[model samples]
Target: MDARRGWLRFIGRRLNPLTLAAARRGSAPFTIVRHRGRRSGTIYETPIIVARRGPDFAAELTYGQSVQWYRNIRAAGGRCELARGDEGWQIESVESLPVAEGLAAYGPPRSWVLRLLRRHEFLLLRVEGSGGDASD
Candidate 1:
């Protein structure tokens, strides 16, 4: 068990709404994703950092493949709508990034994203679900 991972989990789980809101709206790329709960039938909205590869929009999940959000997308095999402020694009949930590649794609180990990779290799999820669910 990685002590660092545990600490990060603790922090994220305990993050206040204010900070989460700031992170979601700050200069860093932000997107609001709608996904179903793993065990529950209700859908939830979560804001995540947006990583762009050309026209494609991707997200780097800090919980790796085991993260709740990642699993939610996989479980429902549902579409994802990535929204930035008032603008957004629809994309499918197909591309998944593994550890080594995710780390490399995220770049140097000095950035916060690098730190996310150090604890949990991000999920390189792609978006392309056209005419999918974008409405609340």
Candidate 2:
């Protein structure tokens, strides 16, 4: 696990800058998550894949729950900003969704890949003013 984490970190560092640029351009499957550091209070923008489920969004926890962005968002009252193309949303809440339920938010191919990769954890974000249950 440590080795995998190291590899992911290495790859992420190299790819993040490029990914962030594309994400800022409003690329599909890429969303820019703006969050603050839990300790340093420094702001960070992370690129992630998100799937819309009703008025909410679901993000696969590809790096599990221990990722810095996840921790920071959770620590800071589950509030963050998500930008996709020219659209933006104020995420009001974040919560873990059961594997089965979360998987339903994604299409078959993505769900299958995530399952094959053993990435079962997912975060469900509720957008402010977007009413309706997450399960809808």
Candidate 3:
């Protein structure tokens, strides 16, 4: 692993539990992306920064492209559950976009240090449900 990713994994292991708890309480921007592990088959609830745009949601890939959650979602064929703003969504299509386009979804980086620290790639999810009922 790269130095930055190594450091991020080290910190994520310690901080993610707290973040997950806060997200489960329905925090803004902080949403939950739940997917199954690729090998272990364990369900994981990952906290991520998400922005709802129309019938879609954009999620930040802050920890770079190799994060387990990202891989799991991809491995599972772009299917996952999303909980955001006190609502649940079934995501169907997940597309990885370039930094230029993805940055628009995230608004702006909070700080130069953070901008430099995290990856800019993003996953744009197409929400599959209407009327609070998910089709798949």
Candidate 4:
């Protein structure tokens, strides 16, 4: 949350494809996410990087668990189109993944150990309906 990094994020949001693409290749760089626009219901994309989590494949979100993308997928429940490879996958909104389990997936834990050690509070939504996950 340094001022300089914050400023870069603000400016990065405005860069075009060519420049943004270049940035994505840099260290711990950004990844553009193409999601259905919340207000317009049209498709739009935003660039962000993996915030570091305790798991693999599952990236750590830098913002609050209640962030817009976090909330949107929680509401709509759809796939995330990753920018780099233009690959897409089914996404699940999970607020809880046992610390060790997530740690095994992501990393051994450094400063982010706090995230892993935290008490989890998440709402699980199934890819399908009630028949798949819970009786409710």
Which candidate achieves the best lDDT against the true structure?
Answer: 2
Tens digit per residue, CA lDDT, model 4, 10-112: 6656663654475356423565555665576776555654433312133445444655565555555545454544433334433444445444444445325
TM-score of 4: 0.49
lDDT of 1 by residue, 2-109 (tens): 997887677566753544465456535456676778799687666676566445554566545676666787777745566655566665754555555555555664
Per-candidate TM-scores read 0.62, 0.90, 0.77, 0.49
By TM-score, is 2 or 3 better?
2
Q: Order the candidates by lDDT, highest first — what do you get?
A: 2, 3, 1, 4
Poorest 10 consecutive residues of model 4 by lDDT? Answer: 121-130
Per-prediction backbone clash count = 7, 1, 0, 5
lDDT of each: 0.59, 0.88, 0.75, 0.47
- In angstroms, how far off is 100's CA in candidate 3? 3.3
Clashing pairs in 2: 26-85
lDDT of 1: 0.59
- Model 1 regions lying over 4 Å from their true place: 1-16, 23-27, 98-120, 129-136
lDDT of 3 by residue, 8-92 (tens): 7876788778888878888665788899999999999988877765678777676666888889998998899998557789988
Positional deviation of 42 in candidate 3, in angstroms?
A: 1.0
The C-alpha RMSD in Å for every predicted model, in order, reads 6.2, 2.1, 4.7, 6.5
Where does candidate 3 have its weakest 10-residue lDDT segment?
127-136
